[model samples]
Target: MGTWEAVRRGRLLIALLVAAAAIPPASSAAATTLPKKAKASSPPELLSELPVHAGRLVPSSVVFPIYGDVYPHGLYYVVMNIGDPSKPYFLDVDTGSDLTWLQCDAPCVSCSKGPHPWYRPKKSKLVPSGDPLCAALHSGIAQGENSGQCDYEIQYEDRGSSLGVLLYDAFSLRLTNSTRASPILAVGCGYDQQSAVQDASAPTDGVLGLGTGKVSVLSQLSNQGVTKNVVGHCLSGKGGGYLFFGDDLVPSSRMTWAPMSRIGFRNYYSPGPAKLYWGTQSLGAKQIEVVLDTGSTFTYFESHPYQAFLSAVKSDLSKTPLIEEFDDSALPVCWKGQKPFKSVSDVKKYFKTLALDFVKGKRALLELSPENYLIITKHGNACLGILNGSEAGLRNLNVIGDISLQDHMVVYDNEKQHIGWVRAACNRLPNADDHGLEDGDLSQYASMGVLK
Candidate 1:
């Protein structure tokens, strides 16, 4: 996962939460568990039942309204309901991470003041240390020390860390078909949190991990047959947007897809090697691998590409009326016009579009307009949103963050092993009526009240 970068000061906070371990309960219609390896005759089957409200059938898709922005907030978040008697917690939406967690009230040793009160877990909710999920979290390490309860610790790149235990709790979700379902999921009940930031009030309660991993919430949902192993988000430049899980919300056509790269880290969504271009001219930078990470606030490039891009932009601006704003500390690079710029729209005309042409797909090109790479600071100057990854300890890694993803519908199709994107008006949710189920699609879900 990419580190969370503070847009104001460019500080990085990388995340790595450890702990582990799900099966849906039988009492709830929405709950169903994957068969244990010892009990199953073949591969675990899909849920034999889906919850139905009254007599009407519902879709498997789950949607959440996204809040916050790229500037002051430096991240986007969503409110989620958890536990038996559901309570809401504000979670930062992160596609780069896999383990979803919440700050716990288990006699917190070191914790930040989050938006909500700490989560109080019942004894029954604790995941047993012997569980397979718990073993997965303790992978690559010895685990017998925590014999009774599953213990976990996540350390970030910025030296921040979270210590906690694993627990199974109900995730209250309202499907796109306008019906509610509560699926049991594994979550980290963090009791200790050490952050690099000194701010007392935490920006979010915790992170909602949407990465492609077995322990991810998406995989848990897929295991229970609540939804397909797919997720998509639309972050509007204006402020708020929406996120959805399942293929039901995916468009039938018109979106461009690039095959997912397995070159580097298996957890991230990488689209293989891409050549950088300033308009139609090549920047002479080598083809670099890029990862689409929502956890990062700004786009990042290798040192060579960063320097090349910086020089090109500066040389282009020399011919224009825009002058370098050396005093502005909002970003590494800033440009001031004759008058203060209120938004990207006010100064975008002065800048050229950037493009990334991927080598793996059929002319797969990600176009970054001036709006996609420029931010209007509080001082009313346009600042560059692209940063140097090498300085941030990213080394050769290139990342596409929130600034470059604004107003685009980016989909992580884990089931198909591909990533797709298309320009969109992200301020509102897609019409539910446009995504009706196809033939035989209804059979994938079991009848109400039936269980495997």
Candidate 2:
């Protein structure tokens, strides 16, 4: 996803502002600096475990505040515009981020490049900084000047890129039940991030925060005297989910529930509420705490548990090809036959001659585009599959991200204490292991708030 700005419009606005003497002082004016704190970056380890319980839906509707938007990729997104409640502009939406910011022009050292639209008040009535409406709009970002320059910037851990200007606008959102709520949205003026290699259709724009608080969009609505929790259901089929801002749309009694865990508000990257279980066992005593992040497309296990899983599943994995690598930049690996065997040849040439089984029964010829190589941790061999089914199973780890949850519909039902999943995309047919939805173990979802 990408946000674009018109350079000509920016120049014209600058010229008009200069002539009118409306531009703020270039110097002397203080720039807004948000609070800063550093967290330990060491790989997260097991912490004290809490009991694993599911949530139950209470009677009546509960309304919560929400900022309507979409994340097509790690890039472009869309936010409801407040001034023009009917329109949503594509902006960069980040989760490992707290300060929900947009591109704003402020003559800062770090500004977005290229041309795009700038937010000018002369043409719109969207609330400005310090205004009662703007102040009350659930902005967690550090107080900063929204200089009309329409430029902005926000960075991530992987050094994933997002730099642009801020464009003040209005946004409109509706709950699953059609309850309406609109807030002023900050659309990014421009963007600078690499495109995804897999699904190139992702749009990048404003971030939709999943933070917890009476001040977050969800909390604001909940506190605003509504009758629902933010009920989120990611619809993979349509490529987006329905976010109910202020209504209890979930069937709590029929659904499973889990207890909520308090996470650091500033550590936006933490998965926050989910628990990791040992192959469907009791929590805490035999489980681990984990963050379920969609941004990270791969599953990374802690060294200890990871090795244990490999030891247990090694026999199953061994039956497949023992490929030393999977270079996505060049040729991708594709295995054939019931049992895939490791091939020793030019990766590019071999990949073209084969097809990888992404899921059971599903096979696609590998292509060379965006580069990514799958490698073995020890011998540093380029391994084909990354199913690190550790000894801990599902009970000992901290997370089960997209890599592990593929072909499943993850339903975030805060109303009922647990999360839910519905197997949508299934890979069936003959395989060394049945990685299909109907096939494979259903034990993973047996304990959670899973629904038929």
Candidate 3:
């Protein structure tokens, strides 16, 4: 599906902070005296893999931290360095969308107050035409309105678009051993933008597409022989998570693999008959077209099945001592006032964990903890992060957004067409395969501690 049809509308809140934990500053001597040519000309290095399994060779790697916000449940972003004398940029990471691009200095009437100044291609010092990886990129690029410079255009679902050009620059990846390296590739630089593309609140520097399309950044790298076409991410409920490129499996995490059916129309992955589970009870539905999307902030199910699920939840909540009601207009399924919660943490006390059961030899995944589905609002109310999704024109389809997929390592393997997951604490550098969890026995995985 195109980004316009795939993504939900709304601007992610402008993130002003950086996510990397301990990046050593490039020496001032190198920053000042080093020729821009040397910095731009150095052969990009493939990243070293974080060893997890027995003797699995990982040649190239790229690691970036994704950050999330609490209130509006904004989208996640990662820090990527580009250009000569490399400057860091915060890009919203998405697996559903196509084409990776950044806001640049072509010409602008209005633009979001980005985390950093726009990337100037003139000073970037890399020729886009000569890069072997950019050969395909040069074709799609069109000229700007008045300026004849090479330009690219991206249109989104919510009437958003970013216009720019293909620029060749060094894409820096921080290695696991505390060293930095870069791989020169074709990266987009947007000069003009409109609507959600330039959201001031979540003024993202750009977007990094991890999509399965040929035009995507991951596809470009794979074609250039830099890395494999595999992606894994573990978005935490609180915000941020672990993300890695290639099959750099960590020892602490265990994953269950399900083959992705190429028979589907969309470019994304999904499991067949993905039924919803409340503890041991299976709340079956017609069909759950699960789009493992990181673009949206909340989980969305179609109305027919979603409404039934909501009723079951309300009936379950009725068993608890009813709380005094207040204005609870912020969310689709919400409860407010002092009736149930002393704070947001008390939500898990009443709610049961939900599992997604996929058909196959694969396991039923328990990805959504209470904190992942229950969002705390500014009005001291607990709002459900799950929505009807009618506005997005999703009619019998369910979107497995970032919220519901939190604290679980989701691997999208294009080579094997395998989609897998395992429950994880996420913040730690865990390398465990699906070691502890039982895929065959449903009764084995009881819900963990309450949200409180």
Best by lDDT: 1
Clashes of 3: 20
Stretches > 4 Å off in candidate 3: 1-58, 70-73, 123-151, 177-180, 196-199, 250-253, 262-265, 322-330, 337-344, 432-452
Candidate 2 per-residue C-alpha lDDT over 395-450 given as tens digits, one digit per residue, 9 for 90 to 100: 33343333333333344444543344434422211121322223222222221121
TM-score (C-alpha) between model 2 and the true structure? 0.48
lDDT tens per residue, model 3, 1-452? 11221223333221111111211112343223221232222224444333334655334545566665433546777777777677878787777665677876644433566778877665244323323333334332322222212234556544466655555676766543333445566666665567643344334688877767665677766665555787888776666665677665533336777767542444555654577777676676565767677766677777766776777778788877635245655554577655545445766788788777776536756457677777766556677778876655555557777777777778887777778888777664453224332231212211110000
Residue 1 lDDT (model 1): 16
Work out the TM-score per prediction: 0.85, 0.48, 0.73
Worst 10 residues of 1 by lDDT: 29-38
- Give the better candidate number (1 or 2) by TM-score: 1
lDDT of 1 by residue, 1-452 (tens): 12234335432333444533322121221111211221211112232246656863343887677888888678888888887677888887877767788987765666788889988865556666666666666653445533455667766544566767677887877665545567788888877777767555677788787877776888888877688889999898988787789887788887888999974434777888999999888988589989888877789898999999998998888989998998887787999988999888888777888999988978888899998999988888999999988887777878898999999999999889889898888875554458552322222221211111
Q: Pick the candidate with the highest TM-score.
A: 1
Lowest summed lDDT across 10 adjacent residues in model 2 is found at 9-18
- Judged by lDDT against the true structure, how good is candidate 2? 0.30
